[model samples]
Every structure is written in C-alpha cells, then in structure tokens.
Target: MAPIDLNLLTALDALLAERSVTGAARRMGLSVSAMSRTLTRLRTATGDPLLVQAGRSLVPTPYAETLAERVHAVAQEARAVLGPASQAIDPLSLERTFTIRANEGFVALFAPAIITAIQQAAPHVRLRFAPKPDKAATPLRDGMIDLEIGTAGASAPEMRTQLLFRDRFVGVARRDHPLFAGPVTAERYAACAHVAASRRGAWTGPVDEGLHALGLRRRVIAIVPGFLDALAIARQSDLIALVPRSCCHRGGVATEGLQSFDLPVPTPELAICVMWHPRLDADPAHRWLRQKLMALCRMPA
Candidate 1:
C-alpha cells in the first residue's frame, strides 16, 4: 500500500471541521479552488467521501466524523513539538534520571548539596553517580553519563563545560605527625613518606617536579586510585596523603584524626568543572540541573 501524505491530515481535518472547501481555504490561506482540489486528494487518500451535500450545505460523512476530534488533537500536539522551548518547565512534574561521572572526592563534597537541591525542586528526579577511573569521553559520547564533574583535561572540542570551583592540593597526615611539630620546610616535607593519588597509578607528577626544583624529593611508599582512599590510609598511619582541599570535610582536612598543611613546594591550583555533551546544553531540564549544581558549588566555602 502507498504511504499516506501526513500533510494531508491537516487538510482533511480542516475539511471535516468546516464541511466547505471555501471555509477551509480561508482558514488555511488558500484559494477556494485549491482547497477543492486538496479535498479531492484527501478523499482519495482516506478512501472516504469525508463530506456530502445536505440541503445546500456540506456536512461531514460518518467516516469523517470519526476522525474529526482526534485529528485536531494530533495536529495541535505536532505544532507544540515543533515550537520554540522558550517557556520554562515545571520542576515538580519532571521525572528523569541523570548519571554523572566524577571522582570520589567530588562526590563526597558535592553529592549531599546536589541531592538536597534536586529533591526540594524536582521530587521525581533521581541521580546516579559513576566513579571516574579515568578522564575519557566515551561515556558522554555513548549517553552513559549525563554530566561529568572533575578537573577538566584534554577533551573533545564539542564537549560543554562550566567551572564549578577551584581546588588546591593539601598534604594530610595524622594530627601529630612530625611534619607539624615545626615550620614545614621543603627539605623536611620531602623527607617524609608520602601516599599519592593517581588514577593511572603513577607515583610522580607536578608535585614531585616542584619538589625536585627545590633540591628535594619525597618518597612515595604507596600509590592509590583516589584521594579518599589515600586519606583513609593517612588517617591511621604516619604516611602523608596528598589530596584536594575540597576532599576535606567541612572545608578542612582535619576531620577523622587527620591534619592538612599547605604544601611547601608550589602546586598548581585546579579548576573543577561540570561537563556535558553539547546535545543537552539547551534542554530545559538539563539547563536547570546545571544551574542548580553551579549555584550550590559557588556558595561561600
């Protein structure tokens, strides 16, 4: 069977509702003769006369009557789907699950605030947090993750990102470690055993480079995949854990019997960001989610 021209549905609806070629033509801004021709085509497509003369006026046939209300509704819905999305969406009615990829430190520091804000605004929305084993764009490209929160690195040019905050590395260890007994010096800091966090399990990075510049070198006894794990190890041992300052609960690393001190060697400050694929940049719900997260992160720390 031949496919029906969907455009004819609008013409058929107008014909059924108006029951006159002249009326439909005026409503749709077409000539009366053009409307008459379109009516003929619509009748041939639907296999129905659709309208018939009744006392010098046209009226819908039984078949056309059956399609009148439903056709109008479908046409209205189609128009809405094609229209601009300038109107804001109602958060209370939003029901969606957003998956975000981030490191353990980011989740520990930001998840609570994000959850609270999402719950208070959109009760039906759910959140799934995925661990970031590495900085890769495959998940975002494949729709596995809705957003990514971490320090932005080399990424595809099409990916979208918004900076959430800045973070700096802080050296953490048991509260009374010998490093705290005196002013922290490059030589003294480099003499201690250190626990380093690297997703790739590398023992040395910019921090080691900076220390080496000062004619000092720290011994890394263990390498961990995340800052929280390094912190866990440092909490009970004499080894120093190098982690982001944001990982410190309540804006300090002193929680859980650990203490944080500024690194004697200069380390680069990191820009934390929320990243997503460009496809979702303008979606109403996605935009709302980004804004809420940004607001929470920008709060005074």
Candidate 2:
C-alpha cells in the first residue's frame, strides 16, 4: 500500500548488473555495510533472494535475471526524466567514447572526414568504428554501439533512423582491365569474372537481379565479406568489383590502381542511413554527434 522509494530502483539495477554486493557498493558509491542493508531492503520488497553465492562468486537468482533488463531500463528512464532539460554542452569540453558499426566501404570513404570533424570540435572525444557483420539490432538495444551506418534493413521498430546519403553501385576493375578499353554492355559485364561483396557470403545481389532481367548472369569468381576486400582483389587481378560509387573516390578503397564504370544493368540506388536507439533521441551529446555525421556525409566529395 506504500509508495516505493525511487532510489531503490537505481540500487536494484546496479546490484542485478554486478551480482556482487561489493561491486554494487562501488558502483553506487556506498560502503559495503550500506549496500548490504540496501540489499536486505531489496530482498524484503521483492520477496526474493535476488542474489545468491555460488562457489566464490555471486550469481543472480532466476527472478533477478528476469528483472535485470527491465530495472536497468527504468533507471535510465528515471535519470533522463529528472535530468536538466536543454543543458548546454560545450563540444570543446566533452569527453566521451562513441562506438559506431558500419561497413568497410563507409570506413574507407567517410570515416576520415567524420573523425577529423569530431576531433576539431571535441578533441577529447574518442570514436570506435566497429565492423557490421550482420544487421542484428542487439548491439544498439544493449547499448554496446552508439550508432549504425549502412543501408536500411530489418531493424527494431523503435529504432531512430536518419538518411545520410543516397548512392548507386558501380563496377570497378584494374585500370588497364579489358572492361574499360571498350564500352561496358550487359553481356560484356557478365562475361567478366566478378567479386561479390556480401557479409553473409551471398552470391546474388540487385546487380544479379538486373542481369537476370536481360537473361544474363555474371561469373562471380569470389565472394568477399566487404567492398574493401573485393576492391583489394580487383586491384591485383582481373576480377571485377561492384561497389558504391561514392566508395570509389580519392579517399576510398577504389582510389588507386582501379577504375569504375556505371553498372551496365540498372539497379536501385542505396539509401545509406545512420540508426540509433530511440533512448538516445533526446540526449544532447548524441544529438551533436549525429549532426556532425550527417554534415560530413552530406558534404560534397
């Protein structure tokens, strides 16, 4: 019948996460005895032994495991609700780390610009660019990654996305390759051995579908995990690499020893976007970072 103390929710989240009274105490900046007393209150309030000792380490009980994620979410929402609104953030004074998951093509083409802009505005900020092995939204949901940059895919409905740029695929090969000496026709394009860039090692793509419309198929000699690898192979061999047009510029993987041509078969343009969890929608620091990325990606190459 009594209202619960909101501070207990914060302690509950920390205790469930750490699973150790000492660790939870350190996290909450409380003495061991104080944390022990708080744990007692938690056990009584929930009618469960949230944590139990197993061997030398503490483990969460079944109920605690169920409550862990929910409690953490509640604590975050509480903090966001109570925090200062429209707090002025000085980029020069900001110190934080942001993890972004993107494909190799984006890294090679646009990462340098984004990094330079961030460093100039916030010298203390650190950026960690992670590989996009798959389209799973777990990293974003679990707060492991700050942003995801790539083509639109099946993602959580609650995720926030902003269009960064639009791009189209272009075929690339060694500068002196025979494909460049003559006009690139659908049949000529299909005759050449190609390198497919797919993180899942897929043999087919929109290009293949386009070729199929004209009753033709390209010979895919190799399947690489990313565009950069495909370009690397194309640079040294006769294999043709299909990559985004923007990724073939001076700063990208296709910069040297390679030449690009428009796809002989028409394919859909790619809409590259930056995605984030909605929880960060209102965070000033996150907003600033997103703005910087959008500006950098939209800049004239």
Candidate 3:
C-alpha cells in the first residue's frame, strides 16, 4: 500500500469544518486554488465525494459527516504530541513511582529524609529503593532504575552524575572499647582487629593501603558485604568497623552505642553522587527528584 500523508489530515480537518474551498483557504492561509487541489487530494485518498454542491451552498456527504469528528480529534491529538511541553506540572497532582538503585548505607543515611520530603511535596509519588551490588550502568541505560546514588567509580562515561556530598571513612567501635581510652594513633589503629566492608568480600581497602605506607597492617578478622554488617559485628565484638562518617551519624544507624573516631591515617574522601542516563536529562519530574536529593544532602548534619 502507498504511504499516507499525515499533513493531509490537517487539511482534511479544515476542509470538513469550513465546507467550502474559499473558506478553508482563508482558515488555513492558502489560496482558493491551493485549497481546491487539497480537496481533490483528500477525495482521491478517501475515495469519496466528501462535499456536494446544493444549489449555492456546499453540504457534506454521509461519508464526510462520519469522518469529520474523527479527523478533527486525531488532528488535535497530533498537534498536542508535536507541540512543546510548556505546561507547568503540579507536584501534588503528579502520580508516579521512581526507582532508585543504591546501597544500604545510602538508604540508612538519607532515605528517611528523602522519603519524608517526597511525601510532603508529592504525596502520591512513591519511591522504590533497589539494591546496588556493584557499579554497573546497565540498569540506568536500560531504564530499570530511575536514579543511582553512590560513588561513580567504573560508571559508564555517558551517564550523568551530580555530586551529592563528600564523605570520609571513620573508625567505629563499641563505646568504652580499649581503643577509646586514649588517643588513637597509626600504630594503635593498625594493631586492632578490623571488620572489612566490601561488596566483593575483599579483606583490604584504602585503610590498609594507608597503613601499609607506614609499614603497618591491620588484621581484618571478617569480611562483610555492607557497612551495617561491619558495624553490627563491631558493636558486639572488639572488631573495628570502618564506615562513612555520614552513615554513622545520619539516621541513627551507628549512633546508638558505637563511637566514631577519625582515621589516624588519611584516606581520600569518597564523593557520593546521583547518576542517571541522558534519556531523563530533560524530564521535569526526574529533574525535580534530583533537586530534592541534592538539597537534602546539602542540608546541615
């Protein structure tokens, strides 16, 4: 079959509404001869005498009457689809669910405030927090996850990232532990047993490398997948848990009976960011969510 001309729908709608070649030409800002040609094309396309002359007036045929309303509706919808998104959105009126992929540490630190802010502004908006086991852009590119919060290491270069905050690692242990009685030094920190938090269960991290620079090493007695687990073990036993300072104080995760101290050896501060695919770059709702998260992170702790 031959391809149909979408432009003809607009002309047809004008022709049917005006019911006269001169009137349609005036309405569409075209000459009468041009409007006549358009009518001929519409007639050939529809295989019908859409307009018939009745004395000095033009009247629509049964076929034209049946198509008039449908063509007008379709034309209106097409215009809306092609037009710019200039209408303002009301958050309270918006109903949507956004999925965020992040680790437990981020959830524990920021989920409560984020959820509360979202609820207060957009009560109908729901958030789904998914587990991020590793830094992979597949979910973002494939549209499975709306946003990702974490370090951008190994992330796809095409993904857009905005730094949420800067966080430093801190040593956490149960209060009144022998390490807290006196000032913590490089050697004292290295001599203590530690719980390593690594998604891959690695026994070493930046802390170990820092200690190695001083010709010292900390014994990692256990390897855990997340910071919470490391803190859980550290709270019960004598093992020291190294976690982000924000995670320890925010959301009361490690603040109960655990004490956080600055690392004796310096490790680079981790940059936490929110990442998303370029597909959502211009989306209004997605932009709003990102703004909310960034503002929440920037709030005073």
For each candidate, give its TM-score against the true structure: 0.87, 0.72, 0.90
Q: Which TM-score value belongs to model 1?
A: 0.87
What's model 1's overall lDDT? 0.85
Where does candidate 2 stray beyond 4 Å? 1-84, 250-253
Query: Which 10-residue span in candidate 3 carries the lowest summed lDDT?
Result: 247-256
lDDT tens digits by residue: candidate 2, 15-118: 98888899999999999999999999999999999999899888999999999999999999998888777657999999999999998778878888899999
Off by over 4 Å in 1: 1-6, 29-34, 85-87, 249-254
Clash totals in order: 0, 0, 0
Q: Write the per-residue lDDT of candidate 3 for residues 1-301, one digit (tens) a residue.
A: 7887877899889989988889988998999999899888998988998998999878999999999999999999988888775446689988999999999988887898999999999999999999988887999999999999988565899999999888899999999799988899999999899999999989898788889999999999899999988888888999999999887768374667899999999998899899999999888898989999899998978
For model 3, the superposed segments whose C-alpha errors exceed 4 Å read 55-57, 85-87
Model 1 Cα lDDT, one tens digit per residue, 1-301? 7775766777877887788889999988999999889988887877988888889889888888889999999877766776786559889999999998888877777788889999999999999999888888999999999999877674566899899988888888889898899998888889999899888989896678899887888999999887888988998888998888877744344358988889888889899889999989889999999999899998875
Report RMSD for candidate 1: 2.7
lDDT of 3 at 192: 94
Kindly indicate the candidate among 1 and 2 with the higher TM-score.
1
Q: Which rank order by lDDT, best down to worst?
A: 2, 3, 1
